[model samples]
Target: MRRTTRLTAAVLAFLSAPVAQALDTQTGPVRIDRIAAGFTDPWSFGFLPGGGVLVTEKGGRLWYVAGGSARQIDGLPDSVPDGQGGLLDLLIPRDFGRTRQIYLTFSKAQGAGSGTALASGRLDTEAGRIENLRVIFEMTPGSSGGRHFGSRLAEGADGKIYMSIGERGDRPAAQDLSRHNGSIVRLNRDGTVPDDNPFIGDEGAEPAIWSYGHRNPQGMAVDATGQLWVNEHGAQGGDEVNRIRRGANYGWPVIAYGRHYSGQKIGEGTTRPGMEQPEFYWDPSIAPSGMVFHSGSGHAPWRGNAFVGSLKFDYVARLAGDPLREVERISSPETARVRDVREGPAGGLWFLSEDDGALYRMVPE
Candidate 1:
């Protein structure tokens, strides 16, 4: 992989001027700047080791963006671009400098339908291509629909790979241990199941399952304390953020704070025995997506807090406090339909807006 700091003239021109006005919030004044634009349905992005970034579009395009110029990186795996399925989250591991290894999640064709799959490969920036690409894990393909593929990737503190897979629109399937749908799977970097996984010896249970009963958890992050947290979509009004526990059931269709789209009550009531409760929830459903726990000292006031993008509300939610609550709604025209939010390697917060088809950076003014 090669590194380049050369900036294209057009990008240099855009950066020469302020992209947007400074917005004051609880964290003080901050500026949101456009890093790159013209993406077609960008879903996620990751910062490269030396410089630049790798962005994924839902239409199966992987882009190498730097210095305000963008180029498509070849060698992407075969992915189905049907509805919500396509090239999704990207992960640039902590050891990318030495290993040059990166991970990605996409919807793969499984017989008649498609399911979420995880793949790993080496990024050759000099050639603008991926090499030795191989699928590490794939869900059992049965359900068929374009909605709720819940593909998100996170590197756990323990060095394991954590991925979220949605129920594929089959409500009851979230509770089925035999299926990989509607659950978070913990695996080794090479896509093998860890021996200490929650359901290792349980008969009929998929060994990769870390926790089950999630409706469509699109947002996941590990806190400073190494705790895993996930924000899942609710039926109508019950979007929830839960502190993920090993072997715990998160109660999706069974017990939810929201009602069905038809305004009918969901399975059972809100509180149910043997199921976990959300640490925080949104009554009107913000349609949350990518998530990241802010670290380092980029914005002193925002350190150690969590930032979640609201796809429905066109804002980034800052959640803090002991029990966790929304501290502020960071909004700007650049936040329209936020799909992913990640903390930059050096500092500051970066996000992708699906509506604008652009990438942005948020920094303290």
Candidate 2:
């Protein structure tokens, strides 16, 4: 009972129509189309400017998918595919048409361990390869475990690059400004620190640190209003969606809403005066990943709403309003282990399902 929903014509018609009213859910029946399949642990994907998509698999492979076909793209750096490590996120810059550049986040191998790394490269679709690939940044003093590489990328309205790195399973490091782990780092496109960074002249702090004390922020996006938002995983419960700010410390390991997996209490218990609070939190932990704010006429009713993928619960959570809260949970068989979600160019919602090993597009039916 599934069918393709043609949206190109409707998009054109919607362009000339009056603004549509926002609906709590879809205004009509919807269908999910399988964009491409056969992916193995696909981590992230981005739409190409012309047509098609670039997908990354945690096993260190990149694929160019389009027109129901897929081809591997060459020239990716070696990525360490240990537990919860490997190629993590892909970002297609707003200036891609002019720059032909793309950014990536991955687990870079470090001595006896690994660290979160940020890289940039030029995509040559005709050649099916990435050229001029180079590592722009790597977490300092890499840790000994393969866990907690909080690798997500976003380009701000001011044009600075933002990246998140987890505490590498070391709790105290989140509070240590000397290390890049457990903090969001802001940098120039060429890997240089911005002059106005919060810690430029500070004696024991990394210069690129913008905000500290975050734990495994896997999803990040810059909304239409230029506000940056992130969704991160919690130990057992206490997953959070936070509105990011400069020089702010989001308490980690120090204060949290959830207890440790073994039923032990976590640091100072939730509200610490100086630390910023989450705009929203999940008590049972959805194990969230991938984030996007919807826009455009194709999904007019959903404009400005936030969409996040839930890995543990196998669904996509739609959040909206001033006091952000989950308004809807879009779940189906194809949504299992939702790894990433993106707003398609035409304004349709597309998501990657790790369990299905496929990419799916949601469109009005």
Q: Pick the candidate with the highest TM-score.
A: 1
What lDDT score goes with residue 239 in model 1?
92
Predicted candidate 1 versus true structure: per-residue lDDT over 1-365, tens digit per residue:
22122323334555565779898888689888888776779999999877999989998988887765766788988999989899999999889999999999999999889999999999998898999999999998897879899999889999999999999999899999999999999999999999999999999999999999999989999999999999988878989998999999999889999899998999998989999999999999999999999985677777888999999999999999888999899999999999999998778899999998888898888
Tens digit of per-residue lDDT, candidate 2, span 235-291: 989999999988889999898878899999989999898898999999999999999
Worst 10 residues of 2 by lDDT: 1-10
Q: What's model 2's TM-score?
A: 0.92
Please count the clashing residue pairs in each candidate, in the order shown. 0, 0
Per-candidate TM-scores read 0.96, 0.92
> What lDDT score goes with residue 145 in model 1?
76
Candidate-wise lDDT, in order: 0.90, 0.85
Model 1 stretches with alpha carbons more than 4 Å out: 1-17
Q: Lowest-lDDT window of 10 residues in candidate 1? A: 1-10
